[model samples]
Target: MAQNSYRRPAALLAYEVSWEDLDGAETEVSPPKLVEQVDVPATDQLELMNALWDAVTFDAPWVPETSEPLRLVGHEGAKSTHYELVLVGPSVAGGSSPIMTDPRFAGEHDAWDDIALDKSVDLFLDQILVPLVEVYGLGNMAQLDAARLSKMRERVRLIYDKHLMGLGVYLKAGPTGYVQGMKFVLQEMVENSAYRLDMANMIRDALGESAQNKVSIDALEARLTARASATAILAVVQAVLVGTDVGKVMYDLSASWPEVAWSAVSAPALFALSPSEGVVTRDESSVKFTVLPKGATSGNYRYRWTTTGDYGLLSDLLLPDAKVLDTREREVWYFHNSPANIQDTDRDNVSVEVFEVPEGATSIPAGAKPIARMAALVRGDTRVIDPRLEVNSGATPADMYDSGETYPCVEMLLRFPRDPKAYGYVVSIVGMGGVGDPRNPNYHFRTGNGNVDYRMDNKIGVNVSDYRGTCAWYNGFFGGDPADWPATEPDEIMGSGGYDASNETMLLMLFSAVDYDDDEDLGAEADLWKEWARGATFEVFPLYPEDAR
Candidate 1:
């Protein structure tokens, strides 16, 4: 919206101070002095002319029908002073006396008409213009920018229209009804004055430091509230008396007031995670977590883990004999025995048993060895182990065991330590040799052809929880016709496998260690084995709950 251009012909009103003698003769004490010059849009021309006439004809009561002028009575050494007003403007050729005959006046002249006109002018100056001038200079309404002034005027017009233009209720009720409607508008403005001022200051601050101190919030609020009430009351009264639109009058008047600036609201900051570390039970059905920067009281937040894929391996917790092996082809833990080879007939004859020993045990369980003695080989890719034992049975008679113990056997006992942190563990044993010699073709026994057999056994402790079922062990002999062997590939043949147990107290695997057949015929004598132990590898994972996303 554009700013109002208050351009029009200017009118000058001058007044002379005078005193009257007791005989009813008047004498001028001072020459006429300029009071004010007024200019307004063409729409307001008639109103301005009427006010000028009233100010100039204020002495009408003293002029009686008999054509005798009344004298001013003196009191306590002071004489009453009278003001004789003269208006010079385009509408008035000689003075304001001609205004009564102007067609714009549109009424029969009478003594009371002069009196009411005089009062209207007095109210306009004393109640409306004076208060506004005290806060802002005359014709300096530009202090309020065009857009802001337009908005303020729109608000005033809205209130006036809503309350006053109700099916002509105020028209039927007269001036009193219009006054009451204006009072409702004034009440709302007064109540919201403080809030509007605060909003204005916020806008000023956002504009930068220079605009912040342009006006004081408290002072501007007080002045504007008082001035608005006074101007609004006079505007309503004039509207009722002159049959003009109260909304337009208020809209026009608001353009001369200071602007209350405004701005848009900013967005909120990002939220933060509540707990630094998150932990959940292994194989738990659900996840629990918290996030913050909680907004309004009714607001809620969602959470999620940003990282993906399997949980990271706990490298530090890996056993001393175990080494993490990561390559383009595979990722696993390669466990090796201290002495890769154990030779002794007595060691081979006895069944191999593996067990986990507690930290403070006073005495070792009979025939039970420290779990560290049994090296563990764990595959990181599948996170499970497949143990297998292979034996060659078709070698010559001299190559076979003399005791007739056809199969080697091994036994293991696994126990969980206090407060175990891993989700589960895997243990596997792979062997491929037995008493046999393939070179003695004539002495071949039991279908000969150097037949090889495989088997596996696994057991879980009672304390274990959430046990995933075991996988089948591959079974077949290497010797018979290649087509007669197991349908699966030879190298893929494995023992009982793939069990997941949480909080496991103990586990056992039973098997016998036997010598490999002399297939190469190197003639190297088999060394005796006293105590035999191989490295055992394990893959452990800690459980974590899923994210809430």
Candidate 2:
């Protein structure tokens, strides 16, 4: 079963590895990460190279940070609030998660609360509290025992709550404000949630996970969210934040605690999507695509637009089949009520023989004088129509009206299939959590997937959404209500300073199933022009309701 890719390389080529760490230096320098690469003579044998790779990998050592005692660099509280709990010890991924370094600014679209709370709790438990407890001998005491840990967790809960209430500040700021300053770092941590367990192990090792020591969670709670152990850690975080000597603080807190036993915390299983036991085949439209149910737990799973008036957008619908669903925006058609030359004079009749509009969609009138014409957004003086432009066999472009100015077309149709949902046109997916009673009319929603909301807004001036939150604008299928659009022509908020959720814009091309020759199987194909696709299997996650987390 081993293929050519698995075969040993024939050459003796050198290999390099890298990492990024914030070291206290005048400036970042060579081998900049806390860890340095291991050097070995080149070898033609794969096994030998892999062995060297393993040795230098997971168990490798790292350089210590250049600075000690992270400080409140900005956001001064009359004087420097040197953070108490310093969890900087062993590097899991080249550096320890630190509370006392640097300041951050949230991105225009970043949900700072979402970023900070999740990270703070995770780090508080795995990186900070767990280690202190293990070193002090205050846990449930048995790595293999579960019931005892559960009982001790009650006291731990009270401990965390009491301190959180007493300190009234988190990391020198109110819990919310303090974390806003760490937005960038916090976002990185959220992106690497898989690092949570690794961080726990790092904490365990830092506390001496040797023949004499073992560590486990006290109450795992539901995986990642509201961990009782983590919550408990919050109560004692103040000790770490303020302690001039962490070892002494650990010793003192354990001595004050009356618990007679030590217990390990349980690990919680993460809630993740899985593949369903079903088959997927292509849908027959002019294009080819396949859809199968990605299994979801029997709970809330619904992903929709977070911003009002912002439905997803697709750029093109002309291809008979598409190997990849193209979100890059391109104009399918543009016509002027008072016509002017949009093209450099080759054809004068706009083609519309293949334009598909939904039966009830208002973008295009139900009945109008049909044109044997099509249009494309073209460049330069070229009369050549790029075949990506969906034009019928006899279709051609229309000439400019004698007025020499192209007036607006009152009706513009985005090529949408009859049933968008049936064909699965929704783009991004986000897991949501609900607040308050679900039966109440005023119930609210929260994003709780612990993953960054996958958005289509990346590239500028393209068919897909631009979500970098940079306030850049493009002329694609604008998802806002037509009534809300300015009375003037398409412009970037010409009369309006801005709109809400300035972070995103999307254009989705919905291609319905085209009939195929194969009755037992469905298939479609489209020339995703430019050969930009790398043949990666595209996956869209199912969204969950806010109440379901």
Best by lDDT: 1
lDDT of 1: 0.26
Report the lDDT tens digits of candidate 2 across residue range 1-549: 001111111111111112122341222223211111111111111111221212222112210111111111221121111112111111112221222222221121133233333333333332234324432233322131222222333433444453333222343243343323223222322244443444333333333224215345332212222322533444333433343233332233223211111111111111211100111111101111111111222221111101011111111455322222222111222112222332221111111222224443334344532211221111112122222222111101112123222221111001222222221233332222222323111111122331222323222222342221122223335546433322222222211111113322222221111111111111111111101111211233323344235
Residue-pair clashes per prediction, in order, are 25, 62
* lDDT score of residue 338 within candidate 1: 19
Tens digit per residue, CA lDDT, model 1, 1-549:
011122111122223245455554666544332332222111232222222212222122211111111121222222333433222211101223544444422332342243333322322322232223222211121122222322443343343344323423322232354354444433544566543454334323322233335656666556546645566545544544344333334343334211111111111212222111121112111111122222222222111122211232211122232122111110121111212121110010001112334544433455553221111111111111222211111111121334422221111222233224434334432231222434221121113332322121223222121122111112223344322322221112222222234443323222212223212211111100001112223322233223212
TM-score of 1: 0.16
Q: How well does candidate 2 score on lDDT at residue 54? A: 21
